[model samples]
Target: MLWFLFCLALLLGGYYIYGSFVEKVFGIKKQRQTPAYEKEDGVDYVAMSTPKVYLVQLLNIAGVGPIFGPIMGALYGPAAMLWIVFGCIFAGGVHDYFSGMLSVRNGGASVPSITGKYLGNNAKHFMNIFALVLLLLVGVVFVSAPAGMITNLVNEQTDMNVSLMSMVAIIFAYYVVATIVPVDKIIGRFYPFFGALLIFMSVGLITAVVVSSEHTLLGDYELSQMFVNMNPNDLPLWPALFITIACGAISGFHATQSPLMARCIENEENGRFVFYGAMIGEGAIALIWCALALSFFGSVEALSDVVATGGPGAVVYEASFGLLGVFGGILAFLGVVILPITSGDTAFRSSRLILAEYFNMNQKTMRNRLLMALPLFVLGGILTQVDFGIIWRYFGFANQTTAVMMLWTATAYLARHNKFHWIATVPAMFMTAVVITFILNNSSLGFGLAMQTSTIIGILATVVITVYVLTKSKRDLFVNEDGNAIDDDGIEVVAQDS
Candidate 1:
């Protein structure tokens, strides 16, 4: 009961903090009267209303990571939920909200462009290359795990050939929505509704799990039992915890979504409501999953059996439904499917934006960019053939590393602008340190050495660029010609401009 109450308090506190921060930073009166650039046709930008902006933002940020992260976190017992919820608000939510705000202020630039502004040309090029590589790994591997699970769901539920059915379903659903739904209309109608549904479902699911379970006490299970059963020596709780939190806490995927959503934000005040609000919603989802895991499986052995028989999604579905039978199962399936849609759309939009910017193509010609992104999707579909868990693990590590790089660059930029207060800097620094520690603690000799090499290069690039930017701050700090202060290389800085 106390645990539940604590979680509720955290949720309410997070809402307050996120909402207050958004209003304080990007309130409506600060929004620019008009965007600096001419409105592009065909793209969602000019047509987006406030409601549409809200929905698209919600959809773009929701992904499979949140679903699985909390489940994995439960390996450390219910105590892990505390960290996942709080860490998300303080570390993940802030990182995402600020990233969007920074991009909007800069004219809707991506993270790479932001890095370039604070770090320099060389750093920008390196980080962009790194981000692209990481995103490709993320898209293919990250998308595949859920694809496989959805395939399994189709095979079990409807007997429509597995892979083919999953592919057709995904393509058809996204295609119909993308083609018919005006981008702005989609955001307006879908965002708030989707967000509300997400919250309700999460609360309902958590409440159901907690209330129905016989065990009310928090840590009665043995720690040793957590690692008892395994194929190879069971993986430690720390590795799983780090990977799980990485997925939930700070993902590189958020960087991609931040810029894509920036173009349509109704006003600066909306940044807090949209970006940070969505993250809190995601964290709530994570908490529900964690709670479900605890209620359904009392020990690690039980969790392993569930995963072996049905896979992680099944474990999650069963956990969510408990004894409600068919209705519960259907609801579980629908929620899982809906969760990934937001992430997928954001990925598609981000890729298009990157391609458009790279070629200096007009945003009105985004159909051409969409055509370009198809091959990448095909490549991702092909890669789905590999083991889902292995691919997911690799993506999780890569995603955290990419996020750290982004935060490092963002911290430098904020410092230059006199916006790098303790609130932002402390969490950013802690996340950076945590990623480094996780890497060092988990890797074997060869893999660890490679990670160390990458870390060194990234650190050196960031440091050199930061020193250079600080030295040149007098020239570029408040200037508009370079697009340095507002939009980092043309990405929108949501809060700054609003």
Candidate 2:
């Protein structure tokens, strides 16, 4: 309990301290008009209040990643908690803030466009394909999971027989409407309600565990031994824990989600609260689930057994009902059902925007929106039929790979402007090694090399990339007569306007 409370406090404190420091480093200009106003198209760039934007962004990036990821990570014991706190504070918060704020500074441009602006056109093109494929996977995966859960929730709650396909069709239809509609209509209006429900569920479960006489919190886990390997399978903590707890820590998916809020943010200053604060909020959710998992079951061994027999879904359902009773059932519905549905809708919406931005299509018209959206839905619908378990396995890698790209882009931006670049540079190098080591060491992904060999190569790759990026950032930066910095490709580093 002491360690849990301390970790939770660190998450909140990091928001006010590290979040603010990153905000200052990014240099938000209060007088400057944001892209929300400058690129007001009503479909995507319409200005919104800070609170509303924060909720939408929270729901956008946080599908079930925080909850499910942490539940799985809890199998490794309290070491997961340490990652959630520090990773969210230093890596996730900064990654989210820059991804969103840079878009606002660039007229609500998509991640690929921003990457292209900093990393070069080739990167921009690669990210376009990479982000789209990832979103499609997210869209497909979210649909299947939620539809199945909703079907089960409905079947058990009432006598009504809800078929999985019917639920899938309904969710697919919602995604289409949510994807094409204006920003404030569907996503902006309902996300706050969904976000509230998610928070309520987390809070309710935490309170139940604290008051429960039958069980204690995080039984027998020591801070001194927190970093020790506790994985029942004896998997190394390095790449596995980092990949398992992506959203709770740092996610490339957040970068893709950030541009959505960046287009709606009313001011540059709000980026801290909306982007960084939202990630911290997610970390808190992860912490609560981790503690509950560790304590709710008799011990870490019990939790591992539950995972082996029933998976994360079983753990979530059993824990919810066990602690909160009937109310837990409803909360489970919200956690498994509503959470992913919200993210699925936005994944498609983001795909539409990315397509529009890439092709230079005018989305002000319904025709253009439909043209860009229809194909993604068609592809997503078809993907729902195939076995994507193999493809989904790669998402963790792809997700972190995108994070590496965004972090490097951010590092370049900071270096070009002469602000503190090490903040991003350090994490960029760290995650780059994580991704490299993960693929190399994992049997399904790479050569199935030993961890020792993989770690050495990963570290060497990180060094090479860092040196090249730093040297290129120096060579690419040139000041014109107007004193505005420009890159080697002749793109303006900072817009004089918004």
Candidate 3:
């Protein structure tokens, strides 16, 4: 319980202290016109209240990753809490803040567009495909995941046998509308209600854990137990734990979502509250879920058994019901359901924006919007036929790889400006090693190299990338003071704000 409280305090302190410092490093322009006002197109660029933007951003990024990922991460013992707290504070917050602020600086552009400006055309091309694919995967996975849960919940409650494909169709329909419509329609109107449910569910579960006489919070475990590996399969902790707990710690997915809110933020000063603060908020959710998983099961071994048998979804349903009772549990389950649905809708919406930007298509009309969105829904529908587990397996690595790209992109921006580049450079290098080692060590993904071999190779690869970036930082003079990128012939890639 003490450790849990300490970790919670760390998350809160991270927002007030480190979050402010990061805001300064980015050099927020208080009087500067944001894209929300500068590019106000009523559809995507309409300025919104800070509170609404914050809730929209929070719902957009706070998918099942925080809950399910941490539930799975809890199998590794209390060490998961450490990652959720510290990784979120340092890595996720910085990554998200830069992703949003850079987009705001660049006319509400997508991460691929922003990456292209800073990281060169090749990196831009890679991230264009990378971010698009990640968004699609998020869309498809969220669709099937919620559909399945809703199916089970409905059948269990009212005897209506809900087919998974039927639910998928319904969700995809909602995604289509959410993707094509204006930001203020379904998403903005509905998110406050969903965000309220999310808060209530999180608070209620934590309260239940703390006050329950039947179960001791944190499972009566010593702080030293956190360092011990308790995985039933004996998977190595370094890369696995990091990947398993992506959103809670750090997610490249959040970068994709940031631009969505960047277009709606009315002021640069609100960047910290909307971006970094949202990540910290997610970290809290992950901590609560991790703590609940640890305490409710009474031991790591028991939690592992339930997870192995039914996966993390089982843990969510069982724990919510066990702690909150049937009535509150139903509401809690709805909150879990809402998490992915909200993210899914925005995932498709983000995909549409990225596609429009990639093709240079105007989105002012419903026709152009549908043209961009229809193809993605078609692709999403096709992907729904594939195995959910397979897509998720690839998403974990892709998510982190994308995160590494965002960090490096931010590193380049900072280094060129001659600010403290190490803030992003260090995390970028660390995640670079993590993704490299994870793929190489996992038999299904890479060459199935030994952990030592993978780690050494990962280190060497990170070193090469680091040297190249550092050298480029010294040589690159393409960016002007206004944050526009110049080509070799000195042509500006991104236009300066008028």
Candidate 4:
């Protein structure tokens, strides 16, 4: 309890303190017109109220990460607290804030487009495919989850009454409409209500954990620098814990979602509140779920037993049943159901924007929007039939792999502006090593190599990438004071503008 409280305080304090400092480093100016106000395209670039933008951003990034990721991460013991607090403050919050701000500066462009501007054309193509895969994973993974949750709650296996097929159809339908409609129409209108439900459910869980008769801190589960490994799988702690909890800790997916809200923001001042603040809010939600999973099961062994028999989804159903009873169980189910649905819609919306941007097509008309959206949904729906476990395993590593690019992209932007870049560079380097090591680790889902061998190669790759980035940052189209990249020609400055 004490450790959890400390981590909770750390997340909130980081927002008020470190988040503000990061905001200053970015040097926001109110006089600089945002893409929304400057362009005012009614489809994607329309200005929205600050609260709505925050809610939409929260729903887009939150999804199942803070909930499922934390529950799985908690198995590694209370050390999960260490990653969530530190990673959110340093990595996730920083990635989100910069990604959003950069998009705002670039006329609310997609992440791949921004990567092209800062990192170069090749990186642009790589991130285009990278961002697409991650978004589809988010969209597809989210679809089945809510369908399963609804199925379990209804306890119906038939076609008409309530079924997975029916649920998928309903969800995909909503995704299509949400993708095609204006920013303020479907997503902007409904997300506030979803955000309210998210808060209410989160507060209820916090209350249950704080004042519950059954839950108290056990020493074996308490987090420490020398914490004992309690994970049933006996997985190595170094990279597994980090990968398992990417959403709670530092996710690449947030970078993709930042552009969605970037199109909606009316001022540079709100990037800190909308992007960084939303991530902190997600960290808090993750802490609550992790604590709930730990306490409700009473012991590590008991929790492990349940996980072995019934997956993470079962943990949600059982934990809510244990703590909140039948009524609370249903309410918790509603939260579980609503979360992914909120994210799935925006995932499709982002896919549409990315495709339209790639092909140089306009999104103002319904035809172009549907042209980009239909093929993506069909592919996503077909993928729902693939082995979910395989998809999830791939998704985890791919998710963080994208983070490597996002951090480096942010690092390049910082360097381009003559600002200190290590804040993002260091984390970028750390995540690069993490993904490499994770892939090389002697796990079946990854390349089957010895841990020491993997670590050596991973370190070598990290060094190479770090040096390459440092070299590129010096000359990667350094921007002028007006925030546009300059042409690379001799001594005279070539002033290119945004």
Candidate 5:
């Protein structure tokens, strides 16, 4: 209970403290118009209230990620709590806030455009490819998982006329419609209610753990031993824990999803409440899941045994029903499944937006929307046939690396403004090391390299990136007389009038 409560407190406190510091550093202005009002196209740029935007962003970035990641990550021991709390606060929350705000300052542009403005054309081009592939993977993973789940539900309840591939086809039809339509029509309307249920489910599990006499989920593991890499598998902490707990802690995927809500945020001042608050809410969910997994299983080794035997989904099933009863289990199941739809559809939507932005194409028309979206849905359906394990590993790599890109771009943005760049730079460097080490250690998945050599290489990569960003930022010091940033091409217009 002490550790669980402490983790919860840190998540909330960091919001008020570090979240506020980020808001101040960004100089979130009250009088300035945001992209929501300035770029009202009704298709994607519809304006919305802060609360709605926050809920949408939360559901978009979170889904079952916080739950899924932390359950397996709990196998790493109590260090999961530290990562969920601090990583979400300093790295994930900060990353989300800056990503959304930067888009707001750039007319609700996709991350690729924003990266180009700050990180140069090559960096910008890399983001375009990275965002597309990542969203496609998100589209596939989200589609396949839920389709399979619904098929199981049908099989157990009734001899339904549905098959997994057919369900995938039907879900793709919905994705196409939702991606093409205006934001308010489907996603905006469905999200608030969907998100409410998700919150309720998460809160219910928390309450059960807090009030249960039949089971206790705290004080079973010591803080000292938990922090020092207590994995029964002896998985090194560097990349494994970070990758295992990606979305719950800090994920590049969140940065990609932020622009969806960035288009709806009504005020610059609302950025903190929307982006930062949503991440803290997700961090709380991750912490709760980790606690339940750790304490409810009786001991750390016992829990690891369960995780190893059943994998993440079994652990989720056991934790949900084990703590909350059968009815609770159903609700937890629905909540987990429903969430990915929110993110999955938005991933398709973002891909459309990114491609449209690249070509200077308009999205207000139905025709253009279909042209961009049909191909993605077809590709996503095809991807569903491939092995999920392979796709998930690659997704993890892209997710963290994308985060590193956004952090560096943000660091450059802050440096251009001459504020404290280290705020983002430090996290960027840490993630840089994590990604480097991950690739080195998981050679079958990445570059087959040794651990000691990987650690040294990771450190060196961080140094090189730091020096490059610092030097590049030095040349970006001067703006034109009109205050437009002067690039090689001449005065470039990146800042949003909003």
Candidate 6:
């Protein structure tokens, strides 16, 4: 009951607080003047209807993050489930919501562009590099994880060969290409169908599994067992929770999703609903995954065995739909197969957009975009065949660290805007500070010393840049001889008069 209340409070608080700020940011009179770039065809650039925007936003944002995040969070126990859901509503949703609004306000700029706007060119460059690396890591981990899962499910349900199953899944990418190749017309039309299928199949499988179960609860284990099994000498709950919140709390991927979705918003007013609402839906999906994990796995050892034998996607699908015999297996296959493709497409699209924007590439050339995406896809495919455990561990750590950067950026943005909703800032600050401290505290003396030095150096650099910006702002020194203030590139700032 308390868990439900906490989750509800976080949800409402996020919606109210972030929703209010989004309204204010778009309310700025200058925002109403649609930029020339945005004045293109309604199919691509012009405002979409609120309903269409909502559907696109929901589909785009609901990816592998929710599925894997909750599954891993459940490793911490049901108590962690509470935070996982609540954190999505309060921290994750708010970050995604405002990030999109900020992008829209700045002419559909990506998150790094926003970072550049406020943090300067060096910061912008660093952020872009960071974002690219993080996205690649995400692409690899997310793609492989689900692929492994699906391969396992196929191997288990049918007499199909494991390698053969993988080939089948890979071939499905060709179908994805067919849908996405036209890029503009087909994806915008068919992607929603795929997304809707994902939701329906997932929900249907869950319902079927639950209804067919003889027992309501699968395990007799207590939540305390999770912490009890942890390394006592390791970091405490506060720090662990903060560091591990990538599965539950804020994510850097949300930054990528925001800009991609921002391009789809039909009305400025619908931004709040689409962005925040999708996150809420993500939280709900996470909750469902956790519930399924708990209901299906009798013990951690059993869960590990299943994942090891069948792969994670296989175990998840089999466990999720195992009750329905052959029919359930097919449903599971559909869900797992769609999961990676959806995520992969989004990652490819986002990376392409970043490249296009930064390099000023021709948006009409699908061939060029395909070439650019091919390298990342091939790299991800190769990495998928390697040991996923090591890949996932590194990916998780790096992903979380990237998320901290995003949280800090968002916190700074909110602080600068003077819209300090403590609901968002408190968790963002607490989580980030805790993660930094934990990483520092848990390292060996020699490595810790090196990390501490680099951290200090980074901190100093950030401080110096911030102070420079402040001094410039106060002295009105940002303006050049022509009286134009410098923008992201330290180039002259030009604000279009309302």
Candidate 5 overall Cα lDDT vs. reference?
0.84
Each candidate: RMSD: 5.5, 2.8, 3.6, 3.6, 3.4, 5.7
User: What lDDT does the true structure give each of the candidates?
Assistant: 0.62, 0.86, 0.90, 0.84, 0.84, 0.59
lDDT of 6 by residue, 1-498 (tens): 233345546666666776566455334333454322464433335455556555556656665666665665555556656676657766777677767767776777777787776556776788787777666666666566655666666677689877743653574375346423643465566666776776676676567545664534434555455334222233345545544546445666777767765766655666667777767666666666665665677555555566556545645666656655677667756665666566556666676667666787655566766666676566656766666676665555566655555555555454344343344455555555544555555453113534455455445554553455444333533446886655333544334310
Question: Which residue ranges in model 6 land beyond 4 Å of their true spot?
Answer: 1-48, 162-184, 205-213, 217-238, 241-247, 298-311, 421-424, 438-498
Per-model TM against the reference: 0.81, 0.95, 0.96, 0.94, 0.94, 0.77
Tens digits of per-residue lDDT, candidate 3, 115-225, equal 998888999999999999999999988998999989988888886788988999998988898888899988888897788789889999999988998888886788779
Q: Which 10 residues in a row give candidate 3 its minimum summed lDDT? A: 489-498
Stretches off by above 4 angstroms in model 3 are: 478-498
Clash totals, every prediction:
31, 0, 0, 0, 0, 3
Ranking by lDDT: 3, 2, 5, 4, 1, 6
The residue pairs that clash in candidate 2, if any, are: none
Residue-by-residue lDDT tens digits, candidate 2, 1-498:
888888998999999998888887778878889888988888888888999899889899888788778988988888889999999999999899899989888888899999998878988999999999888988997898788777877788789998989999999999999999998999989898888888888888888888988877865666776777688887788888898888889999888999999989988878899999999998998899888888888667899999888667778888888888876767755665688899999999999999999899999999999999999999999989976466557777888899999999999888877668888999999999999999999998788999999999999999999998877776777778997776433655566311
Candidate order (TM-score): 3, 2, 5, 4, 1, 6
Instruction: Choose the strongest candidate by lDDT.
Output: 3
lDDT (Cα, 0-100) at 103 in candidate 4 = 90
TM-score of 6: 0.77
TM-score preference between candidates 5 and 6, better one: 5
Residue lDDT tens for model 1, 199-294:
666676666655565543244445453333222225554434655666465676787777766766656666776677767767767777766766
Please provide, for model 5 over 219-260, each residue's C-alpha lDDT reduced to its tens digit, 9 standing for 90 to 100.
Answer: 666657656777778877777888889889898888888998
| RMSD (CA, angstroms), candidate 6 | 5.7
CA lDDT, candidate 1, residue 254 = 83
Worst 10 residues of 1 by lDDT: 224-233
